[model samples]
Target: MEHSEHTEPRPPGLIGSVSGLVKTTLRLVMSRVELALAELSEVRDHLVKLAVLFALAILAAWFAIAFGTATLVFLVWETLGWKILLILAAVFAVLAFVLVKSAMKLIRGGFLGMPATLAEIKADRDMLL
Candidate 1:
């Protein structure tokens, strides 16, 4: 005759259950932070692009203003002398307009928001609740 011994698995006690929950919570928080960091890097890139574009726009606007003033002076002195300056001023104004429009489009594309991170956080909150 042979005897076999078997033990039933024990359910987690309060401390063990609480420890598991804490670990899970910490993991969730860490993952969310990592996601935010990744998204912030992308945001940094967008910011750099915006900065460069705005700088160019400002430069173009300055050129437009300067040329417009020059054109005004030329118009007062000689009518035909102002034509080239007026054309240059118009070109610079158009360049500034295009740069600002591109910047607006980038902003509209959600370059400033961490969409995925926000969605994940909302999901996590819903799950916990």
Candidate 2:
């Protein structure tokens, strides 16, 4: 006759349980950071677009003033002719204003920061507490 030995699984000690908790928390934080990084990348793309729009607005404004003044002085020397020059100036000014307003909206979009990351962290904190 032969006797068989049986082994039972041991329960996790304090140290093991603590280490597991730490590892899990670290993993959760890392995942949230990855999400934040992705959001920041998106913000970068938006910023580049806004910069281009701002540049265009400045160029339009410059041209409006330069050419409008030149036209008024050289071609539209008469008082009545000044109206057409002023109208052209007004049109370009409007275009520039629109572009500037668009850029401002992007600036205030509140996406420049890690908004999602902050929200996730807040939720995590709330859950933990």
Candidate 3:
């Protein structure tokens, strides 16, 4: 009779490998969620700052326009009469239109989306696929 003395370890079964894969996938999902949450917090902070700046800018601009228009009308009243006021109104309306259009363009540019989280998720998806 021949004697055999092999001491090799067996490979993991499908169930064990699948369980490990599930754990790793869950960990990946959790980490991605954390990243997205962190990015959202950053976006919130940025939005707060932008809102404050926008409010202050609007206040200052209104004050400047009010005082400057009063001074301009006062200075030009002798020559142009009430026509200067009409002209200034038209100019202000045009300027307001332009500013609104610019704001809309900026908003449509996706300035607040979580770009890093999206890219990472896409990369992970591509690797999996």
Candidate 4:
């Protein structure tokens, strides 16, 4: 009798191949995260960009609301009487004040928090090997 070497059989079907692919994908993702951490050094410019974008958004919203209110007042004045239009203007003014106040609060909060957030991201990135 001749002695034969036993060979391991390969796993059959799509499930085994899929599991191997998933594991390889996860490893690649993990390596990319590591590389990103190592590569991320500065965020000051990024924070500044975000701040500018926030400011622009607030300015745009303010201008849009103001323009819309003006247009609405003009329409109302043309259709309704001046007295009713004045009352509407006053009501809109008060609402605008409230909205402005809220928006200012939000801007203040975002401005205060953004630097700290950027700092944290930088610090975390620094800690990565």
- TM-score for each prediction? 0.66, 0.65, 0.77, 0.32
Give, for candidate 2, the lowest lDDT window spanning 10 residues.
1-10
Best-first order by TM-score: 3, 1, 2, 4
User: What are the runs in model 2 whose C-alpha is more than 4 Å off?
Assistant: 1-9, 73-105
Candidate 1, 62: how far from true, in Å? 0.9
Candidate 1 on 14-108: residue-level lDDT in tens? 98899899999899999999999999999999889879987897899779778887766666656556576676668778987997798689778
Candidate closer to the true structure by TM-score (higher is better), 2 or 4: 2
Of candidates 2 and 1, the better by lDDT: 1
Alpha-carbon shift of residue 87 in model 2 (angstroms) = 14
Model 1 quality (TM-score): 0.66
How well is each residue in 87-111 modelled by candidate 4, as lDDT tens digits?
Answer: 7668878987997898688667754
Worst ten in a row by lDDT for model 3: 1-10
Cα lDDT of model 2 overall?
0.82
lDDT of 3 at 50: 78
Candidate 3 wrong stretches, greater than 4 Å = 1-11, 101-111
- TM-score of model number 2: 0.65
Top candidate, metric TM-score: 3
TM-score pick, better of 2 and 3: 3
Q: List the residue pairs that clash in candidate 2.
A: none
